[model samples]
Target: MEKNELGMTHKKKEFSEWYPELLIRSEFIDYSLVSGAIVFRPSAYFAWEIIKDYVDKEFKKIGIENVYFPLFIPESLLLKEAEHFEGFSPEVAWVTHAGKSELSERLAVRPTSETIMYYSYAKWIRSWRDLPLRYNQWNNVVRWEFKNPTPFIRTREFLWNEGHSVFASEQEARAERDQILGIYLKALRELTCLYGIVGKKTDYEKFAGAVESYSIELVMPDGWCVQGPDFHYDGQNFSKAFDIKFINKESKEEYAYQNTYAISTRVLGVMVATHSDDKGLVLPPKLAQKQVVIVPIPARSEDIDKKLQDYSEKVLNTLKEHGLRAFIDNRDNYTPGYKFNEWELKGVPFRLEIGKKELESNTVVIAIRDTSEKKGVSLDKLIEAIDNEIEAMHNRLYENSKRMVQSFIHNIESYDELKKNIANGGIYHAPWCGSTDCEIKIKQETGAKITNIPLDQSDLHGRCIYCNKEARYMANFARSY
Candidate 1:
C-alpha cells in the first residue's frame, strides 16, 4: 500500500507528532470517541502480552500469584482512608447512577485498587498464617486528568499490572518492596535494553498514599525522562486505613505492614520513544514479537521453489529449536527490498535473506535492525550469529541511552544555575534545606519541581538554592510530564 497520509508531520522534524502517527501506522493503537482514551490494536496488545507473560513468570518464581478484583469500589470504602481519598479525589471518576436509578452511595471506577483490595484483606487475614498475602492483578484503571493526555503516557484510562502484598513486620514489607523494584529494573534492562536511574521520589512526587516510594526513570532519546516502574512502601498507611489486622502466633493482634507496586503499558511508550528512529520502532530483540524474520529472495521455478521451501523449513525449525521467535515472510508479490524496509520499521531483530545464490553457497545474509549491520553466515552457524547479534544490539542500545541520560542532568549549586538549567530544559540537581517554603520558592522562581530525593542520601556542602539555609539533602529537580 502507498504510504497513507494522515494529520501527522514528518518523523524527522517533529518527534512528538511522529509518535502518535507511527502508533497508528504500525497498527499499535488508535484514538477513540471518548476524550483522553485510546484503543489498543493487535500489535500493541501483542507486545503488552509479551511483557506480561515474561513479567508474570518472574513474579510467580518469587511467590506472587495472579488475581482479579472488582472494578467498582464503594464510595465509603474509597473514602475510608481520608488522606488517600483526598489525594485521589481530584482525579477520581465517580459513578453516581446505575442505569436509570441513582444509588445512595456513589461508586468509583478504581483509580487504584488498594482501598478495595485491602478491605477484603482485612476480612481474610485473621492470624499470622495469613500474614503475607502476595497477589497481583492485570487490569485497567481510570484517573480523570485535566491536562492533555498522551497515548499510553497520561491517558484517563490505561492498562497496568498492580502488585499488592502484606507482611507481618516492617522489615519484611520493606524487603519485599525493594525486591519488586529490583525485578522491575532487571526486566526493563533485560527485555527492553533500557537503563534507568533508580532512586526515591521526593515527598511531593511520591505516590499519594505511600509512606515512601522508589522509581526507575528511563531517559528517552530526546533527553526527557519517563517513569519506568515504581515501588511503594505503604507501611501502616493502608493497614491503618483499612484496619487490616491479624493475630500473632502468641494471640496478640497487630496491624500488618504492606507494600504495592506497578508497571504499566506506558513503559512500552517509553521504550518506543527511547529506541525507535525516524524510520520507525527498533524494538529490542528479546521483547520483539517476532525476533527473526526469514524472507526468501528471487522467484524460482516450481522445482527450485520446492527445494528452497524445504531448506527454509529447516532454517525456521533450527531457530525455533534454539528458542528464538522466528517468522517466515512468504508472500510472493512484494520485492525483497520492500520486505526489508517493512521488517525494519516493525523492528524485527534479525532478517535472514536467502536466495538461490546464497543457498548454493550454503549461507544466508543477516541484517540487524538496531545497528543496520549486515553479514553473511553459514547455515550451520546461523544460530550462533543470531545470539551474538542480539547481545551486541542490547549493548549498543544501553550505551547510547546511558550517554543521553548523562546529558540531561545538570548539577546546580546556586539559584542562578538552577534558572539556567531549567530554561535549557533538563533535570537540575540541587541542595535543599528540607523546607517546603524553600521548595515552593524555587518552583515559583524556576518553574521546576522536586522529582526525586535519592535514597543514597548525600549531604551537600553548599547552602540551599533558595533560602541559602543549611542544606540537608541533594534533590533532583525537573519539569516533569
Candidate 2:
C-alpha cells in the first residue's frame, strides 16, 4: 500500500492505538529485540538532537557543565536513602550476575542518578567553594516498568538530560531550581512554540526525595496532560541522608541544599502528538531536519527537465543563503504526488515547488506542511515569504493548542460536575480542603489524579469544592499519560 493510503487508524478516533502506530508507521521508532525497549530512528533522533543542542547551549550559558555518572549504582548506595529507595525499589532493575559470577551485592540500574550522585558528592565536596556544583548528563537510564511501553511516553529505558546541583544555601538552590525550569520553558517556546502551565505537584505526585516539586504541564491534543520540565527542591534531604556536607567560610559545617531539573525525550512525544494530524507529523520549523524541500515537477522534454533542475538548485541555494535548511528533491522516479506525501508525512515545514512556468516567471510555489497552504512567491521575496510562513505556522499551532487546553480545563465547583467532566475526558480544576482523605476520596470516585497545586498564590475561592469546608489549596486534576 502507498504510505498515505495505508489503512491507518485515525488519531482522533482511537488515540491510544493511533499514537503507537503513528510512531511505528512514520519510521520515528521501532520495536527493539528487547520487549520493552524501542529503537529510535533518524527522524525521531534528529528531533531529539535539536532539543539537546538547544538545552545544552542554555546550560552552558548559565555555567553548568556536562558530566557522566555511572549507569549502575551499588545496592547499598541505591538503598542509602530510605524514602527514595522505597519509592523506586519496585521499578529498579538489578544487575545480579557479572561474567558468569554471582555478585555479592547486586547493583541497581540507574533509574535516576540522585542517590549515586549524592553519595559521590559527599566525598568530593569539602568546602563552601564546592557548594554550588552543577552537573548535567545526557544518557539513557532504566527503570523496569511493568506497563506497556509507549515509545516516548513510557518505556523501560529512555534518553534524557538530568541536571543535578548542590548548594550551600536554600535560597541559592531555590533560585537554581526556578532558573532551570524557566530555561526549559524558553527552550520549548524556541523550538516548538509550545507553552506549558507552571505549578507545583501535590504531595502524592512529587518526586521521591524532593521536599517540594514544581512542574510545567503540557496539555496534549487528546486532552490529557504530560508533565514537562520538573524541578525538585531537595532541601538538604539527600544531602543530609548521604552526608553531603561542606565547611562554610565561617568555619561552620552545614548540609548542602540540592536541586534537580529534568526534561526527558518525552517532550518530543508531546510535540508529535500536539502538532501532528491525520495526514502525518507536523514538525515545528526549528526542529525539522529539512525545513524547506524543493520539488521540481517533471517536464516532458529533456531541455525543460534541465531548466527545472537548475531552477530547483537555485531555489535550494537561495534558501540556504538565507540560513534555512533546504534540499532539492530531484528523484527521477517518484511522482510529484508521492514526493508531496512523503515530505508532508516527514513533516517538512516548507516546500518550494520549482516548475517551468515558475522558473520563467522568476517565482516559486511555496507549500507549507502545517496548514497545507500554497502560494506563489517571487524569487525576490522567497526568503522573506518562507520566514513569514514559518512564523505564522508556529503561531497557528500555538494558538490552536492553547485553545484546546483552555477548553479542556473546566473549573468545577460541584462534585457531580467534577465527576462528569473527568469522565468525559476533561482536566478538572477544583478547590480542595488539602486533606489526604479528600484527595483519595476524589481519586476513588473519579479516575483522575491531582496533578498540580498552583504555586505562590493567594486564596482564590472561598470554600472547598468538595467538602464545603474552608479551602486549603486549588488543585488541578487530570488523567495523565
Candidate 3:
C-alpha cells in the first residue's frame, strides 16, 4: 500500500502534523471554505449527535426545557452587560450591513446567547410564581477567533448546548452547579470514555460577569490542558444588567440569580486526539457509528465465496440483533486485507473475519481495535462475547486516559521547579496564595497559568509556589490549548 493510502503519515508523537491528517484522512471532518471553520463528516457528526442526545435527555429529566434564540444580538443588547461585552468584544463578529446599505445598529453575531436570551428573561420573569425558569439551547456560535483554528478544538464557529437557568434565590441557583456538573461528568465518562479534573476557576480566570466559574479540565496528549464543559454562577450580575427582576415570595421585588453551563463539540476533538493512534482514529464503542464490521475473505471459487458471504451475513445479523452497530464490507473491488485496514483506520471497535475455515466451523475471527488481539468466537455465543469486549474496551480506554493524565501531573513545591519543567508538558500541582499578581507574575515568568483550583482541597499545606506566602488552594497549572 502507498504511504498515504496506509493511513497517517505522521505518528502520534508528531501531534501537530498528525492530528489534522488523522481527522481528515480518516474522513472524520474537512476544512470549510471559511477559514477557522470545519465541515463535520458522517462519523464525526454521528458521535456529536450521540453526545447531544444523551445530554439533552439528562437535561430534560432535570426540568430543563429546550428553546431557540435569534442568531443575531443587537449591539445595544450586548452592551447591556459592560463587562461581558468588553470581554468578548475582540472576537465578536458583527453584521453592520444589509445588502448595500449599512444598518443603523450593528448586530453582533452570537458569541454567546446570554445577552439575547436574558433580554426575554427580564420580560418573562415578572412574578414569584415564575420563580425558576430553566431553559437550554443546542446551537452554534461564532467568535471569529484570531488564533489558528484546530477543527473542533479551536474553531471560529462551533456547536454547543448553552444552558441558561434563572432562580428566585441565590441558594437555589448555587445548588444547580453540582447537579449540572455531575451530568457533564457522567456524559464524559459514559459517552466519551474520558476523564477530567473538576475544579473552580480563579477570580482572574472566572467567566466575565460571573461570580464564580467551575470547569472540567482535560489534559491533551501534548501535555496541554483544555477546558471542557464549564458552569458559571452569574449572581444577579446579568439579571440586574438586563432587569430580570421578579416579585419575591415575601411580596417584594428581587433580582433573579442565574447560571450558565455548556458542553461543546470541542470534547469530540479531545476524544479523537487522546484515544486515536498512528494508524488511524480509535473510537470508543458508544461513540463509534459502526461498532462492528464483518469482512468476508474471498475463496476465489464461486461455491466457497458464496458460503463465506452467507457466513459473514449471519455474523452481521447476530451482532445487529443484539443492538450492535454492524455492517458487512463485501466490496469486490477491495481485497480482504484492504477492508481490514480501512475499517481499522476508521476505528471500528470490532472486526469479524469470515473465511472458509470459519464458515466450516460456524465461527468468526474477531479483531479488537485498541488492542490487536484476535480470537475466534462461535456464532452461537457471538453476542455475549461482543458485549463483554465492548465493556472491556470502554473501561480500558477510560483507564488509559485517566492514567495518562495522572502520569502528566507534577506536584511542585517551588517556583524554580515549575519554570524548569513547565515546557516539558503536564499539569503542575502547586500551592497558590490566591493573589492575581502572583498568578500574573508566574504566568509571565513561565507560560503556565492556573487551570483550576481543584475541588479537592484536602492536601493544601505548603507556601505559595511563587510568592512564598501561606497557601490558599492547590491549583493545577499548565500551558493550555
Candidate 4:
C-alpha cells in the first residue's frame, strides 16, 4: 500500500498528534493560511450541515425565527453591557480601518451577537404583544483567541447559532432554557451520536452578564472535559443595557427578560475526538457525507469487469432510491484493497463490495466502518440491512460515549481525594459551598475548575471540599480543553 493509503501515522492514544493527523489525512479538515483558522473539507462541513439543519428545524418548530446580523459590531454597542464587553474584550478582533482610511468608530468582529442583536430588539419591541422575541442567527464570529488553537474547538473564527430570546417575565425567559438545551441534547444524541452532562454553571463560571447559566458538558476520549451547547438566563441585563423595554398591559414600561443559547462547531470537535480512532475518522452514519461506498472489485477479465461495474451501479441506485447517500468507486487504477483502505480512512459508514461473486449471487458484502464487521446481504435485502447497520452503529457510538463519560465522573468526599485524582483527567464530582474563594483555590491548587453543577442534585449531603463549610450543590470539576 502507498504511504498515503496506510492510514494515520499516530495512534488515537497519542491524541495530541493523532487528532490533527486523522482529520487532515482523512481529508475531513485542513489548516487555513490564516493562523487559528481551519478549512472544513466536504466531510466535516457535511457533518456540520446535518447538525445545523437538524437544530434549525427544531428551533422553527418552537417559534424561534432565523435572522442575520452584520458581521461587525460597533465598539460603542459592544461596550453597552460592561460585563459582556469585558468578557469578550481580550478576544475581540477590531477592524479599525476600511481599506486604507481609519474609521471614526472602530468595529469589532463579533465575538458574540448579544450587543448587536439586542440593539435592534430595543427598537423593534414596543408593547406587550411583542413579549417574546425569539430570534436566532446562524453566523460566524471571530474571537482571535490567544491560546493555542484547536480546529473546530478553539479556533480564531468559528460558526454557530446565536439564539437571543426576549420575554416579558423572568419565568418565561428561564423556561426557554430547557427547551433549547433539549434541542441541543437531541442533536448530540441523534445526529452526533454522543452524550453530555446537562448542568448549571457556577456563578464564577457563568456567561458574562448572565444571571444564571446552564450547559451540556462532554468529556473527550483523553478524559478532559469540554463544554458543549449552553443556555444562559440573562434576566434584564442586556435589556437594561440596550433599553429593550415594552409597555405592559397596565401601560407601564418594563425591561425585557432575556436568554441566550448556542450550539457551535466546538461540539463537532468533541464528536470527532470522542468517536474517531487510529484507523481514521469514525463518523456516525447519519452525519457521513457518503453513508455507503460501493467498490467494484474487477477480475481484470473484460467480461467480469463489465459485469462488476454494471452490478455496482445497480446496488448504488438501489441504496440511493431508498434515501441513502451511496456512491460507487469504479476507478481502474486502484486495487480493491487500496480502495477499501482509502474509504476506511475517509470514514464512510459502510462499504459495499460488489464483485464477480456478488454479481453471481446477487449480493454485496457490506463492511461496517466502526466495528470492521462484514456480512453479505442479498440485493433485495440490502436496503433493510443498511438501515439496521446505520442504527446499530449510531447506538454503539452513543453507548460508548455514554459509558466513557460516566467513567470520567468521580464522586469525591474529601478535598484530598480531589487533589490526588485531579491529575488523572476526569470530572471530580465534589461538594461546594458556592464560594468563589473555594472555586479559585481548587483551580489554583489542582488546575481543575468547576465544569458545572449538575441538574441532578440528589444526595447533596456533605461538607464543602475546600472550606469545610456546609455543602450546597455538587459541582463537576475538571481540567478542560
Tens-digit lDDT track for model 3 on 279-365? 899999998999999888888999999988877877777777888999999789888888888888889999998888998889888
lDDT of 2: 0.84
Tell me how candidate 3 scores on lDDT. 0.92
Model 4 scores a C-alpha lDDT of: 0.91
**Residue 152 lDDT, candidate 3, scale 0-100:** 85
Give TM per candidate: 0.93, 0.96, 0.99, 0.98
lDDT of 2 by residue, 1-481 (tens): 3755742457545777777777776677899888778888887888889889889999999989999999999999988889888889999989999999999999998999998788788889999998689999998889898877777877889888999999889898888866798889888877876768888887878899899899988877777788887999989889889999999999999999988889888888888888888777788888887899999988788999998888888888888988888998888778888888888777788888888899899999999887788999999999889888888888887777677778888887777888777756767778888887787788788878887887745746856766788878878888787
The clash numbers for all candidates, in the given order, read 0, 0, 0, 0
lDDT of 1 by residue, 1-481 (tens): 5332322245734767878776766566789998889998776777788788878999999999999999999999998888789889999999999789999998999999999999899999899998689999999999999998888888999888999999999999998866788788877888777777778877767788899889887665555566778999989988988899999888999999988999998888877777877767678777777889998876558877776777788899999999999988988877777788787777787899888877788888998887787899999999899999989998887677677677888888888887865755677778888888888777777778777776676556688888889888888787766
Output the better candidate (1/4) by lDDT.
Answer: 4
How does candidate 3 fare on TM-score? Answer: 0.99
In angstroms, the error of model 2 at 66 is 1.4
Clashing pairs in 2: none
Candidate 1, which ten residues in sequence have the lowest lDDT sum?
1-10
Instruction: Estimate every model's Cα lDDT from 0 to 1.
Output: 0.82, 0.84, 0.92, 0.91
Clash number for model 2?
A: 0
Quote the lDDT for 11 in model 1.
72
Candidate 2: regions farther than 4 A off: 1-11, 456-459
All candidates in order of lDDT, best leading: 3, 4, 2, 1
Judge candidate 2 at residue 141 and give its lDDT: 89
